[model samples]
Target: MSVCKVIVMGVSGCGKSLIGTRLAERLEVPFFDADDFHSQANVAKMASGVPLTDADRSGWLDDLAELVRVEQKGLVLACSALKRAYRDRLRAGNPSLQFVYLRGDMDTIWSRHSSREDHYFNGRTMLESQFRALQEPEPDEGAITVDVSELPDRIVERCLSALGAPDRTGES
Candidate 1:
């Protein structure tokens, strides 16, 4: 079966938007950036170089989960699913939902984040805090982690190829 519902997840500036959009295009699904769902307070907090607490993110995550819950067709969402609990919350929307965890080191992601000119991500402080909060998905989580250093097309290709592959239970 083709990729129907997926989330491209990682820390901020990990190319979630670019890769998620491409993956959505490849899968013929609608794409959404989780940042678009953030409340103004969340944006303002991040803009001021403050890291968001779990409390700050609670409602935002719920909104994103609701987006997943309501979509009947293929859906691709780019979100910073840093914690396992957050991913679990998102999964409550659809149990079969797949995740594409963009894995990258601090230096690489910081480089990318620094180059960006038009986002609320204020400085390295926010990035560092994200690293602190990140809970990389384990083998059992069913997330396919992809390295972000590769070219965009190659990353998308790998995602599609992996998503097309069967899991441990041999179900597609």
Candidate 2:
């Protein structure tokens, strides 16, 4: 089996972590949550409802990219790679990186965010900024885009299907 690095990316509250975990499990590889790599300063800033600048994110992206590069096999990581430049930074060292964009309507995202509890992001404030910052992946970028409105299992199925995994639907 060819190892393939997969990034589950989208705006906050778009279920990147949940889906990425399932996809990684299905693929039998390690799963990473990029949010876990954020510095204490960045976390505190976001907790206070501040949007991160590119400078704030550069180090984090570099860390994620380096993690991917060092892993001999592929893995799945969940990140809110809101900007093209950030995504590029992640792809800089790991040329084989592939993205799985979790696309959803803003209303759905906001609704999900609003209901969540004990998270750093201020749903009301951050949602707008995330949308503002997001640069949708280009059609030619070779990243698979998935509509996140579907069931979680179905989303994993779609991701694996896109990755050319043999049909493991019934078993899982």
Cα lDDT computed for each candidate against the true fold: 0.90, 0.89
What are the runs in model 1 whose C-alpha is more than 4 Å off? 165-172
Model 2 Cα lDDT, one tens digit per residue, 1-172: 5887989999999999999999998888999999999999999999999999999998998899999888778899999998888888898878888899999988988888899998898757778899999998997778888887898888889889989977776756
How far is 156's C-alpha from truth in model 2 (Å)?
0.9
Best by TM-score: 2
lDDT of 1 by residue, 1-172 (tens): 7437899999999999999997887777899999999899989999999999999999999999899988888799999999999999999948879999999999999999999998998999899999999999988999998999999887888888888843223211
Superposed Cα deviation of residue 90, candidate 2 (Å): 0.8
Q: On a 0 to 100 scale, what is the lDDT of residue 81 in model 2?
A: 90
True-vs-predicted CA distance for residue 133, candidate 1, Å:
0.4
Q: For candidate 1, which ten residues in a row score worst on lDDT?
A: 163-172
